[model samples]
Target: MAALACSPADLLPLLGGNATSAAAEYICGRFDAVSSKFVDTGYAVDNTYLLFSTYLVFSMQIGFAMLCAGSVRAKNTMNIMLTNVLDAATGSFFYYLFGFALAFGTPSNGFIGQHFFGLSKFPSQSFDYGFFLFQWAFAIAAAGITSGSIAERTQFGAYLIYSSFLTGLVYPIASHWFWSADGWASPARADNLLFGSGVIDFAGSGVVHMVGGIAGLWGALIEGPRIGRFDHSGKPVTLRGHSATLVVLGTFLLWFGWYGFNPGSFLNILKAYGVSGSYYGQWSAIGRTAVTTTLAGSTAALTTLFGKRVLVGHWNVTDVCNGLLGGFAAITAGCAVVDPWAAILCGFVAAWVLIGFNKLAEKLKYDDPLEAAQLHGGCGAWGLLFTGLFAKQAYVNEVYPGVENRPYGLFMGGGGGLLAAQVVQILVVAAWTSVTMGTLFFILHKMKLLRISHEEEVAGMDLTSHGGLAYEFEAEEKKEISF
Candidate 1:
């Protein structure tokens, strides 16, 4: 909340010498009351905006469920959908219990947060319940991304264990490293900025997307690709999804949710850019952020449409959708600081980044059913680099204030300090996620709890573990009476 610009004492000069002391006191009391009301109104409006954004971000989970359901074979649709549901349900429990604390607990060191465990001393001056809800939505999204990479073949128990750990510990720690004011890499840090600029991950391309993607990369690598993803002769075989309709629908839903994911990161829409009465402010910046996000996603979709048409000889909606998401992931880091034109470039390159990663995955026989690692991980890294290269100095100052002559994008004539900080963010996120999620995946694999038996893989986990196939047309047909 903003402080009152004037106090009754500051206004005392306006009173004439003839005014009585009691009359002056009465006027000051009224002024104080009005000032208190203004503060209350600000909190009310900001909280409403935050809660609405939280709902939009939470809706992305439904989109994830639909996308995961369509990407996998029909035999495992139920199993994948169930995991998506649990990603939200189970994620909520753990994230609420401690994830919020670990990510945003203030008065702590640069590494990990140590206070607010179980939301102790709730709703302090710095944060409120709505803020906690908003962060919780982001924490679960990281878990949702990893579920896509290890879909179909991963065991149910393993999913439970990894999802809990990722949401509760792994993902929160990454967020703390970049988003928290006390974070080591946060641009909002008051002192000792990384490389004298700190990371400018405005909306968490590295903190969320890269963390999720790297974790998925390790899981898929450890699981050794889904059975029969490669033929006996080692040629890559295409395992097409069961439905393009769900994929398209899910993509659109996610696109809708991203408006909240990016713009809502501002957390306050009523803030002014300069004076209190000025037309330009955080709201205008929020609109600009939305524009950048849209441009990046749109450009990536078109690029993928043309690029894939040339390579695959036909239009692929699923590929285009993935490309669109890749663009969004890439733009997330610099959405507030880069121009719309720069966002187009970010998206244009992100499409190729994803396509290139997919080709490499095939060459290495790495199988991700939804291309989660490529679209999120590969493009997410590109987004951080994009910020380092293109972030505008004026916009950077406006978004991250309290720093004088701060470093901006290297390409924008601000020097290489910001770029170096971004590079550090990418390395630290990759290394940390690999150490934690990678080790957990490897341990799960050694215990035979990561993948199902060969027979179950062939039959699909939906029937063996989930009790039935997602679609039961044949079973329904058998129930018909003979004439």
Candidate 2:
């Protein structure tokens, strides 16, 4: 039940003139008790919803592990899987230590947050434990994306250094710039919005996806391609993963987790659209967001299916899987505010965008084993652009309330202000990630900590660094028959 907005004095008119003070006091006390219960119930519901969403988001880590394992050579399978696991573990400690503060601590400057260090005075009226857990899940996901790009040849020590830096500093700063209420580009900002329309990255298309992708781009570039990635004549070589089944499984898992990724961004579900008893409210919006997310991914998968068939003269499940992910990444930014039909367009364009980026990477001899840079970075940029072009005015108002006449999608008749802001987001995210992560990779390269030795690369990091190969099959000796 919604909390009642009545006081004892307001209720006086309902009582007869002969009503006694004792009667009024009794009635008011009862009203207060009921209102308190309602408030408590609301909190309980919201917290429960958030906690469940956090679990869903956390499960994406497992999906990432399976995906990375299936996307790399079997020799490096253990190495890649280990990094994904650490992304969650290390990301948790660092994000709890200071990442949350840098991204959400309020009463600070717009550029960065400064409060809530180590969760001091935590579970306040404004922030709670559930919120922190949800954000932590997102932080690890960024690290997971970068791990894929530099897989197969990266040093384990290098992975630790970069993952910590990214979760604790780089990703937090970028998220603060867009997701924090006090951020300069946040639509939730109370005043002085960017271009009178803040960047509408509803679910971190730029903050998470672009940052991870760009960081991966630099890491892979600095490390150079894996051994045997290209020939002496510069012809690209195919380094297919050992298992396609794992790729399909991982893709489906990611698809399931996206329900939490996009809709869960609401942070609360008990809010009503206008009145408490109304059938339409935030719950309805959440359902719409889920629908849009599904449509975009589905459309992109089908588009890639046919598109790849034409390009390569064959139906490639791996290519389709990547295309499906590209669509999800692109639609994430606008899922809540766009119509379902618009999501289809977003997914369709995202498929081609992934294909185009893949072609460009091949031409440039840029090798990302799982296409993390091209799929996440390239398609992520397009997702932001799609939001700027398709977000609906009514939905925008509903999602980012208290902002009147805010500019929406340019193609939706709102104007170019929102689109311009999105473009700015793309540029700033690219520049920031390149400068920070690119420098880190460069230093690691110079210090001989980024890429493994050629010997390790040829033999695979699983064998050289991870104790042994991921899979070992040997014939048993005749002596085993004694057992």
Candidate 3:
């Protein structure tokens, strides 16, 4: 047993003492007296931000499942849901195995990732594994976006192959160039030269959404329209989704989740480690991003409702959902930079653009079941341009201190430099994604494995591909009749 004599007055001086304080411990003790300080060392689980991001991204998967299942014929609902499930499960496995390495590798060069596999050579302390898991959710979302566009027609095996390639290679490579530290689109890199801002994709407009849209386009082009989708004279036919209720529900989920998606991309709201702990470095930027994203989504939904009324003379729930998504997609590139008002304006414009592209794809005979091209590609391009037009000097300085901030846009009283950069980024993404995804589709087509037989298409994917039906009720009803 050890005893020490220290009064409350004695401890107070020790805590914040002046040099003149000479209070002696005049205690004759049998045991040694020692003072020790304790540090609360902890490995913080930053799951608040990661969980939000994952939840948003995972919700996108659910939305995708519902959207895909709704768009397909009722008989193929189970098959479509299965496809969405496989996309997350299998795609997540691949992303963890190899795709993450490619997308977020330690930079040997500023081009694509040179690392070969998952977590290769990365020190455990350098990265939180949860970060990788969150990114995996994004990879899964990208792969699933195309599932609806080619629903009920694509072969199951072929779909798997495409999903694997999209998650493991295509999306990873694009994300690396944009989101990774050594990427060409890295904001720190002055060598890009084409843009003063270095292809500012705050979230993943060009990376995730555009990549998914391009892949969907290739798949649709290779597979052709669904059977009975066109007459002998090539007149178009509109095939309705299985359930509008499911579609609306999915849209609401996605809308709620976007609050997490754009803001959580900050990774750390409390302390983001990029450039000397600037005010706009993490928390502030993310706060603004949340505001912008919310504003844009709301404006887009309203604009879509109004646009459909004016154009089609009826209120279409599907278009409204698409409008909201399109606005979200458009703002994704610069969600952290643009003001909330700018975001609302950008979203309002994006609704019209998305609707235009939807109609345009139809005129071109492109059978896109989900309008991914409009929601991602057309509106994503708008996001990039909006950054040029709406990015403020104060926000830029706070976000990236010591970096040369450019003032452009019609409102900011600057010239066309920023706009030029936006155009360049858009064109580069379009060209690269189109060429690569198109080639992959061409290879699949040459193998004659892209689409199932015409008879199988009519039977629906649930039976032809998966050998199952969504509604066992109908089957049971027939059995009762026979009995």
**Which runs in model 3 stand beyond 4 Å of their true positions?**
1-47, 122-125, 190-193, 272-284, 407-410, 478-483
Candidate 2 wrongly placed segments (more than 4 Å)? 1-6, 9-13, 474-483
What TM-score would every model get versus the actual structure? 0.97, 0.97, 0.86
Write the number of the candidate with greater TM-score, choosing between 2 and 3: 2
Per-residue lDDT of model 1, residues 55-138, tens digit only: 999999988988888899999998999899898888999987878878988987888888888889989988999999999899
> What's the CA error at residue 349 for candidate 1, in Å?
0.1
Residue 235, model 2: lDDT of 93
- 427: Cα error in model 1, Å: 0.8
**Mind giving the per-residue lDDT tens digits that candidate 3 earns over 1-483?**
123345544554555554232333332121123311111111233456677677777887788887777767887898789888999888977887779888776754777776647676654544667678788888888888778777878878877888888888888888877677777766655565345655667778877788788788888988888887777777788888878888888888877777777888877655544675465446667778888998898899999999899988999888888899999999988787777889989999999889888788877787877888768878888888887788776665555445564544646654566667777778877887788778888888889878888898888878876768887888899999999
Q: Which ten residues in a row have the lowest lDDT in candidate 1?
A: 2-11
Winner on lDDT between 1 and 3 is 1
- Descending-lDDT candidate ranking: 2, 1, 3
User: Clashing residue pairs, candidate 1?
Assistant: none
Clashing residue pairs for model 3: none
Model 3 clashes, total count:
0
